[model samples]
Every structure is written in C-alpha cells, then in structure tokens.
Target: MPLVHIDLIEGRSEEQLRQMVRDVTDAIVKNTGAPAEHVHVVLNEMKKNHYSVGGVLKSDEK
Candidate 1:
C-alpha cells in the first residue's frame, strides 16, 4: 500500500481538491506501480495562523 499526505492552506474549491487528489493518486500509481485501490491520499488543510514563513504567520502575510 502507498500512502500520500498533502498539507495546504485552506480555501480551495471542492473541485480543485478533488482534481488534486485524482492527479496525485494517478501519478503515484504510475510512478510506483501501485494498485489504485491500495493508494491512499490524505489532504490536510491548515489555518493561516497555524502556518508561517520568514517569521511571519500566513494570516499576517495576507
């Protein structure tokens, strides 16, 4: 089984997230020769305040 985890900031449309999962899963299946049913993808949405870069929170940057 292959497990992929993706983390991103919130606010993406449902379709975008769905497409992302599909594309990522497809890529993993193609690259790793994994079965579609055995490939698992998990998406984690983080609050702006929970992420930071360059000493600034994402919420503050925006």
Candidate 2:
C-alpha cells in the first residue's frame, strides 16, 4: 500500500480537494504500479491562524 499525506491551509472547496486526491492517486498508481484501491490519501487542513511562514501567521498576512 502507498500512503500519501497532504497538508494545506484551509480554504479550498470540497470539489477541489476531491480532484487533487484523484490526481494524486492516479499519479501514484502510474508511477508505482499500485492499484488505485491500495493507494491511500490523507488530507490535513489547518486553519490559517495555525499556519505560519517566516514568523508571520497566515491569518495575519496582509
């Protein structure tokens, strides 16, 4: 089994997330020859305030 973990700042629509997982699964299957059913995708969505870059929180970005 192949496991993929994706983390993103929370803002994307459900359809976008779904499409991303599908595309990722396809890529994994094509590259590793793993069955689609055996590919696992885990998505972690963090609140903007919970994410930071260069000491600035995403929610505080101007």
Candidate 3:
C-alpha cells in the first residue's frame, strides 16, 4: 500500500479535490507500481485563519 498526504488551504470545490486525488493516485501508481485499489490518499484542509505566510494569515490576505 502507498500512502500520500496532501495539505492545502480550504475553499476548493469538491470536484477539484476529487480530481486532484485521482491524479495523485494515478501518479503514485505509475511511479511505485502500486495497485490503484491499494493507494491511500489523505487530504488535510487547513482553515484560512490557521495557515499563514510571512506573518500574514491566508484569511487576512486581500
């Protein structure tokens, strides 16, 4: 089994998320020779207020 962890800021559409995971799974399977059924994708969505860059929170960005 192959496990993949993806962390991103919240607000993406469900379909976008689904497509992202599908593409990731396909890449993992292609590179590692892992079966598609055995690939594990874990998505961690961080709140805009909880994520920051250069001392500014994502939620506070214009």
Compared with the true structure, all predictions reach lDDT values of: 0.94, 0.99, 0.97
After superposition, candidate 3 runs with Cα above 4 Å error? none
lDDT of 3 by residue, 1-62 (tens): 99999999999999999999999999999999999999999999999999999999999999
Colliding pairs, model 1: none
At residue 38, what lDDT does model 3 achieve?
Answer: 99
For model 3, the run of ten residues with the poorest summed lDDT: 1-10
**Among all candidates shown, the one with the greatest TM-score:** 2
**lDDT, candidate 1, 1-62, per-residue tens:** 99999999999999999999999999999999998899999999999999999989999984
**Each prediction's TM-score against the native?**
0.93, 0.98, 0.96
Q: What is the lDDT of residue 27 in candidate 2?
A: 100
Looking at model 1, report the run of 10 residues with the lowest lDDT sum. Answer: 53-62
Candidate 2 residue spans exceeding 4 A from truth: none
